[model samples]
Each structure stands twice: as structure tokens, then as C-alpha cells.
Target: MLETRSLTVRFGGQAAVDGVTCAFHRGTLTAIVGPNGAGKTTYFNLISGQLRATAGDVFLSGARITTLPASRRARRGLGRAFQLTNLFPDLSVLENVRLAVQAQAGIGLDFLGLAARHTALHDRAMAVLERVNLASRAAVPAAALSHGDQRKLEVAILLAMQPRIFMFDEPTAGMSVDEVPVILDLIEAIRQDRDRTILLVEHKMDVVRRLADRVIVLHQGRLAADGAPEDVVASAVVQEAYLGVRAGDV
Candidate 1:
């Protein structure tokens, strides 16, 4: 579980994320949705340690982690998939994931062993790949995969970390509509694991409506709505401030 209290992220005098409080509970899928510049990603960045909060606290399972470095935060059961693809194109899919598993296993110093010799890491990496439906492409160089496949590979790489909390910023951003389903399905599978908390920041209403157990709407860097998907979707403030259309009209 993760919680942010009065989290504020400012650049100079301008606040990208205003004081806001929210929580992502274990085994649940929570979505942060809003129009462009609503500070959705900014808030996520603060919670995930990509940016330090100007004011407020971030807690994971009741421990304050606001001051922890990104690497330490990640090592403490947090994982993220960036809106932009981050992958080692020159490496094989299996190798990419192997590196992640190796890092998570605290074997980054063990360069003496051939990566292939780490059978346990290899097996676990393959298992994560299988979870994302990328098992068959494990041996292929990451550069050869399609964009959607590459995104799935990114997810697989993050999965290799065995994180307890996952933050996905626009996980389906560049994919075709058809390609979106695969990522959506993969997200659903991960959510059902009942051991991780997922925070999804996405613009696709269809995906949000389908996957979000709870939805929080942000408008102009503030919380505009927070509740069950259906409730938030129908709230007057959410429609007026963000969606610009009543739920029934849409």
C-alpha cells in the first residue's frame, strides 16, 4: 500500500502538483485520470521518487519514504513503467529481463558469472515474460520487437523486480487501439495477483472505466473527484472540470 499526504510538487513558484492526498491499496487497481496538464504524471513522479515533493509526505506501508532516493525506493518494493519506453534495444528480451532480475537479486556485482549460468534468475525472468505474454520472443533482440511487444517487454522487465507497488504512467500511450487490449489484459492479470498495488495514470477512458476499481480525477493540479469508477465518472465536478461532458451524455 502507498499513501501521499498533501503532496506538493513545484517548479519555482508554479505548482505542477498542488497539495493532494490519496492512497493506492494493495490488491486494488486505482486510476488517476484527467485532461492534459492536470498534474497526473507529476503526482505519480513524486510518489515514485522521480521528483521530490516540495511539501508533504509519501508513505509505503506506514513508513515515510519521502526522502529516500529512487534506487532505494525501487529496492523497497516499488516499480515503475515510464510513459516513454526505457529498454536496452541491443539486448535480447531474456537478457534484458535477466539484468532486471539480477539487479533485484543484488547480484549486480557478480560479473564473473555468465548471465546464462544464473538459472534461477533466468527462470524467474522467463516466468515474468510469460505473465506478459512475451515468452516466445524471449530469445529475440529487443530491437526487433514491435512497439507493443516492446512495451510488453518493458512491463516484463519491471515485473522481474517483483515489486509490491507498481506505478504505470500511460502504459498504453503509443500503442494502436488493437494493441491496447494486450496491455490492458496484462494489467488485469497483474492486478488479480492480490499481492500488489497498482496506480495507473492513463488518458484512455475505456481502459480506465474497465480496469479502475477507484478513479481519482485531477484538474488544474488538484483533486477534482475520487470514488468508485461509476460514481466518479458521474460526478458533476469531474464532468465539468475534466471530462467536459456528463457521464450519461458521453
Candidate 2:
């Protein structure tokens, strides 16, 4: 559903992402994995428009969106969550999600309308919060929630937008052992929707092995390998690029 063609960027005469081309299809979750500084997040930024490409293009559903800003891209069905929570610190969790639902529905003026008049928005937001297990905390300010709950809230907001493609950068990072499964389970549920496309940039091999339909290994900002998870994860490219081990050593 999304394609990046020779997508690349540079800083100080170095290519962080170098001519990498890949297509992510509907109904499949592709995991991008590599060691630090391998340009995993940088690649995401390029696609999502946080970083402009020095060269190449990004396309969503066969339309070129290489030059669109992040917000515009988001409006066109690109949903992203980062390692750091992006939220209104002062808004109640319900308000945060309600706003997303409002934006998705293209209700520009009704944001200032009374909550009583926006019963549908309230209901939709509450339902998303419940999916992320944050319904009970709807009245709590997003800033007041625990780190794990904040992560859940972020996911809840992403769901409220109902984007066609979901991009998560390190969804489980910094989450507690007990909290990890909640996020993972939600991702699994999203994957079950055959019309949705999911892109996960994650470090944990176990998590990748468990959740990914396909795996793409990046090394020095290049597409080093791409294949089925079991095959790519077990290949020489992943062994050498990801674990820094040569095939003979294994």
C-alpha cells in the first residue's frame, strides 16, 4: 500500500539512507530491523515527511507524496507513533482521542461545540480508549498517566484516526514486561485486519519474529536483505548486519 523508491537522505557528506526501495503491501506487517545508526528511524522520517529526502520519492496507495508535509501525509492516511509520546500534556486522554476522531471525520468547526452536541465523538473516543485499555483513565490528563499508560494512550489516539497504514517506531521500547503484551496484542489485532498495512521499526528480534509477516534488514542505510521473517532473520545478511557476525562464525 506504500512504496519508497530509492528513498535516501544525507548529512555532512554521509548517506544515512542510501537508495533504498521497498514496497509494503496491504495485510502485511513489515518489520525494519538493524543495529543503531543503521538509519531505521531516519527511513521512517523520510516516508512520513519528518525528514526530506535528498533524492527519491515516497508514494502512498500509488500516489506520490514525497513533498507533502507530515500533517498533510497524516490526513491522507499515514498514522505514526514514535518512541517518545506525542500528545497534549494538558488534555484529558479522552479529549486527545476525541480530537483525533474529530480530525478524521473532517469536523473543523465543531471542535469548539459542546460535548453534549458531540455524543458520537465522545462514544468513538471512549471506544478507542477501551481498546487500548485506557477507558477507565479517560478523565486523566495524558501527562499524568504512567509511562506505559501514556504509550497506550498514544496508540489509542492513532487508532482513533483510523489511518489505512500504521507506522510504529519502537512500540515496545521503555514499556514494562507486563505492559509489553498489551501493546503487542493491539498490534496483533490491527494486523488481523486485512485492509490495513503496518510498518514496525523495532529492535527486539523476538518481537520481530513474533509479529512480522516480512523482515527487511538495513545496514549502513542500505537495504541489505528482504524476505520472509524466518528466512531473513536466519540469513547471512541479518547475521552479519544485525548481529555483527560473519556466517563462518556461526
Candidate 3:
């Protein structure tokens, strides 16, 4: 559903993402894995339009969107969540999600119709909160929630956008062991749909093995290995670049 053609991003003398080309098929979960400085996040930023490509193009569903801004890409069904929690710290949980729903519906700027639009937006937001298991805390301030709950709320905000393509950058980062499964399950639920395309960048090999239908390995800003999780993880090149070890040692 998403394709990048020779995408490159150069910062002064360094190329963070260098001519990397790949495709993410519909209804599949693909994991992008590599060691630090592998250009995984840079590639994501290029595709999501958070960072502009120095060269090459990004296409969503066959249409070129290399120059589209982040907001425009989001409007076209591209949704992203970062490694860190991002939300309104002071807003009630429900209000945070409600605002996302409102933005998706393009009613946030409709001051004249807000009263009529709010009721529908509230219901939609509540439904999304329920999906993320945060309905009970809908009235609580986002800052008051646990770290894991805050992460879940971020997912809820994405769900509120009703995206067709989900790009998650370490959705479970920094969570306690007990909280990991909850976030993982929520991501798995999104993957259950056969029409949505999901791209994930996760450091947890177990999570990648359990969740990804395919794996794309990056090393030094290039596509190193792209295949099944077992094959990619077992690759000598991947092991060497990612862990400085041979496959047998793994």
C-alpha cells in the first residue's frame, strides 16, 4: 500500500537514508529493524512527510506524495505515532481524543456548528477510548494516567483518526514488562483487519517475531535484508551489522 523509490535524505555530509527502496503490502505488518543510526526513523519521517527527501519519491496507493506535508499525508490516511508519548498533558483523556476525532471530521475549525458537531465527536471519541480500554479514565487528565495508559491514549488518538495506514515507531518503548503486552495487544488488534497496512519500528525482537508478517532490516542507511522474520533475523549480514555477531551465535 506504500512504496518508496530510491528515497534519500542527506544531512550535510551524511546520508541518513540513502536511496532505500521498499514496498509495504496491504493487510500486512512489516517491521523495520536495525541498530542505532540505521536510518529507520529517518526513512519513516521521509515517508510520513515529517522530513523531506533530498532525492527520490514516496507513493501511497500508487499516487506520489513526496512533497505533501505531514498534515496532508495524515488527511490521506497516513497516521504515525512516535517513540515518546505525545498528547495534551492538561486536557481530559476524552477531550484529547475528541479533538482528534474532530480534526479528522474537519469540524475543529467549524465554530458555528461546534455545538451540533460536538455530540457526534464525543460519541466517536468515547468509542475509540473504549477500544483502547481508556473509557473509564475519559474524564481524567492525561497527565494523571500511568505511563502505559498514556501510551494507549496515543494509540486511541490515532484510532480516532481512522487511518488506513499505520506507522508506529516503537509503540511499546519504555513500558514496564507488565505493560508491554497491553500495548502490543492493542497494536495486534489493529493488525487483525485485513485491509489496513501496518509498518512498525520495534527494538523488541520478540515483538517483531510475534507481530510482523515481514521484516525489513536496515544498516548504515541502506536496505540490508527484507524477508520473513526468521530469515531476516537469521541472516549473517543482519547479525553482523546489527549485533557484530555471526548467525550461529544468535
lDDT of 2 by residue, 1-250 (tens): 8999999899988999999999999999999998888999999999989999999999999999999999899899999888788899999999999999988888877557676687899899999998999999999999999999999988988999999999999988899999999999999999999999999999888899999999999999999999999999889888878876422333
Please list the residue runs of candidate 2 whose C-alpha ends up more than 4 Å from where it truly belongs after superposition. Answer: 109-112, 245-250
Candidates sorted by TM-score, descending order?
2, 3, 1
Candidate 3 deviant stretches above 4 angstroms: 115-117, 245-250
Candidate 3 residue pairs that clash: none
lDDT of 1 by residue, 80-189 (tens): 88888889999999999998898899887765878668799989998988887889999999999999888888888888888899889899988887878888888898
Give the alpha-carbon lDDT of every model. Answer: 0.87, 0.92, 0.89
Choose 2 or 3, whichever is better by lDDT.
2
Candidate 1 C-alpha error for residue 13, in Å = 0.6
Candidate 1 has an lDDT of 0.87
Q: How does candidate 3 score on lDDT?
A: 0.89
Lowest lDDT sum, 10 consecutive residues, model 2, at: 241-250
Best model per lDDT: 2
Total backbone collisions for each predicted model? 0, 0, 0
lDDT of 3 by residue, 1-250 (tens): 8999999999997999999999999999999998877899899999989899999999999999999999999999998887788899999999999988887887656657654456988999999999888999999999999998998898889889888899898888878898888778888888999889999998888999999999998898999999999999888877788756323334
Query: Candidate 1: deviation at residue 144, Å?
Result: 3.1
